[model samples]
Target chain A: MTEPVTTGTEVPHGGTADKVFPPLDPSTVSPQLVWLAITFVALYFLLKKIAIPRIGGVIEERQNRIQRDIDAAERLKDEIDGAMRTYEKSLADARGNATAIARTTQEKLSAEVDRERAEVEAATAKKLADAEARIAETKRKALSSVGDIASEIAGPVVKQLTGKDVSADEVKRALTAGAGE
Target chain B: MPDPIHQFEVKRLFPLEIFGVDATFTNSALFMVAGVLLSFGLLMYASRGRSLVPSRMQSVAESVYEFVAGMVRDSMGEQGMKFFPLIFTFFMFILTLNMLGMIPGFFTVTSQIWVTAALAILVFLTVIVVGFAKNGLGFLKLFVPDGVPIYVLPLVSLIEVISFFSRPLSHSLRLFANMLAGHITLKVFAGFIIMLLGAGGAASAIAPLPLLAVLGITALEFLVAFLQAYVFTMLTCMYLNDALHPGH
Candidate 1:
């Protein structure tokens, strides 16, 4: 704080506040403008010709590539959906066909079993009818024979017990009456 | 030890006079070239291997591209894309110059009002040329507000014209003043550190405080460097927008 702080005035150069402050300085304006123009125009052309286009191109390329990949993914997804639909359709069709085949086979087997059962029943009925006819015929013969025996036995016993011979007409009449009783 | 402003002195690096004009290439010119070369080198190197997946430098390039692109596109619409190169060039130039000034002993090119004003005037001239070329007689409509009464139209038009003409002044002064003031502030604070240290033992202890402030301001100045460039580019876009759509 003791020593005075020197400003731009003592710089020994021409660029002190006295000259530089009036931004409209005649000496510095033209050169600065000239250099600025030269460099700026050069820089502009450099950017236009090289820098911007390359950077912009690469970014645009990347974006386009990403879009293409997304489109491909969407297309593949659609294909998968189509394939799955077809597979499901075929599976349903196959299941229906199998069910139809099973039902027809089941119907045919049931019809065949019914026919066999009917034939077996018819044969058993015929056998039963023959056996019944035979039993009836035997029963008729036995009844007729029992009647005759009864008559003959009755006449002999009567004759033995009474020690008298009975007439055939009387014996027949008595046997008939005893048989009726 | 002499003066902080002494740092702003423009020393001629090469003496060259053309057509009886003192066009000796000065330190300002040197840094101006340096700024251009730095920007070109950075951009060229960054964009050399233009990759889909950007490398670090590639990202830097892409970021700068998108940043300027967005500024031009948002403010001026698709039609404004034509000015991207110019705006980008200006942004890079000013940004590089501002940053160069931050170096220990480099010249702050933007701190020179003439330099900044020249850039502003260039933008101003471009706006005028483009405005008239695009809109013809309609460019004058920029001075006439749509809602103003006929009687007050003259007054409003004068105000508009004044404001329109003031664009270059404001644009150039904004950058120049900011760079100049920031440098001056830094130099003054930096001067404090030396003065405090010069005061010897006890004062030197407090010198670190100003040194700390210098560090903070230096960081702020770095941000200002980028922001000023951005502001200049944004304003250029806005002015260009006025040219393109001169009706309102």
Candidate 2:
């Protein structure tokens, strides 16, 4: 702390030897402190007023922008998801309608085939009955003719055997009585 | 070899006498202003773009700001944001000074005890003023520890008081001593290389040893420079934390 406050930095006036240790020197301390306070105070105000706020503002602005961008991206993603869901729902609905249409057409076609089959079977049955009736009439007619022919042949044979002619009415009555028995 | 202490000598660049006081603008003052101005200009210039995506220089500037900003926030919390400007000033100013001193032949302002002592005293005074202003009489409760036995409480309190008062001493000396010793070691190692090289054949061959030591110690000094700045700022934060919430 020895101080006579010299004009130069070193204690020895003319020597080039830097013998005075400035760190421990008491003489230069006040000026060092004074300039320190001056520059330090100046620096404090410079940073406080201009540098810090500007940098901080930039950082804060970037953060806000990032958050906004993220939010927008999230919203877009949600919209895309909504659109995807709608597309899937409609796709499923179309699939169900196609299946229903195919099933209905199949059922309708099969029902038409069944109705035609049933109608054809009924028509075949009616035709068979009509054919049977006509056949039965022909058979009845032929049997009546056979009876008449039999009556005539019997008369002729009786005439030939007995050498006498017999009436058709009498033969007919005999054949009828035989058939009944 | 020249005086190893020669680098620390303050040469008067511009002499000014104000009312019989020697407030001469020395080399130390020149570096102080240079450090302050360079950091200020760099930060201002880096942030000039204000780009959402920062440039390399901008990122570095922002990182430094955020580093100190984060330090204050962690130690002192959101309420301490009011002191952010002061804290930022203290951090960057001291950081620039320490880093500038790492350059060959540059004057280290922090190597002086008065400057560090003055800064420490400023922080000490800030804590006292802020503590009393924030908590009034409860600021004194900082010395009282929780869960102490009632009988030994007085001894504990006295010890706490002593530690509390010694904060500035330790704070100032920690930075000054670290810088002084680290620089001296580096200078000594450097001196060894010159001495060895000045000697003839075999001794000159081994000069690389001290040169290597100089290199390694220089790298270590860079770490120490940054570390001391960080330590000083961190301690300031802790002390301010006490001021903000003096109960603990």
lDDT of 2 by residue, B1-248 (tens): 64667777777777787777778888888999999998898898888888889999899999998999999999988888899999899988999999999999888989988889999999999999999999999999999988899999999999999999999999999999999999989998999889998997999999999999999999999999999999999999999999989878
- DockQ of all candidates, in order? 0.38, 0.52
Task: Compute the TM-score of each model's chain A versus the native chain A and list the values.
Answer: 0.69, 0.58
Residue A67, candidate 2: Cα error in Å is 2.0
Question: Could you tell me which 10 consecutive residues in candidate 1 chain B have the lowest summed lDDT?
Answer: B1-10
Per-residue C-alpha lDDT of model 2 across residues A57-160, encoded as one tens digit per residue:
98899999999999999999999999999999999999999999999999999999999999999999999999999999999999999988888899989889
* Candidate 1: clashing pairs of residues: A6-B3
TM-score of chain B of each: 0.97, 0.97
lDDT of 1 by residue, B80-142 (tens): 998888888888888889999999888898988888888999999999999999999899999
TM-score of each: 0.79, 0.83
The TM-score measured for candidate 2 stands at: 0.83
Fnat of model 2, as a fraction:
0.78
- Per-residue lDDT, model 2, residue A151, is 85
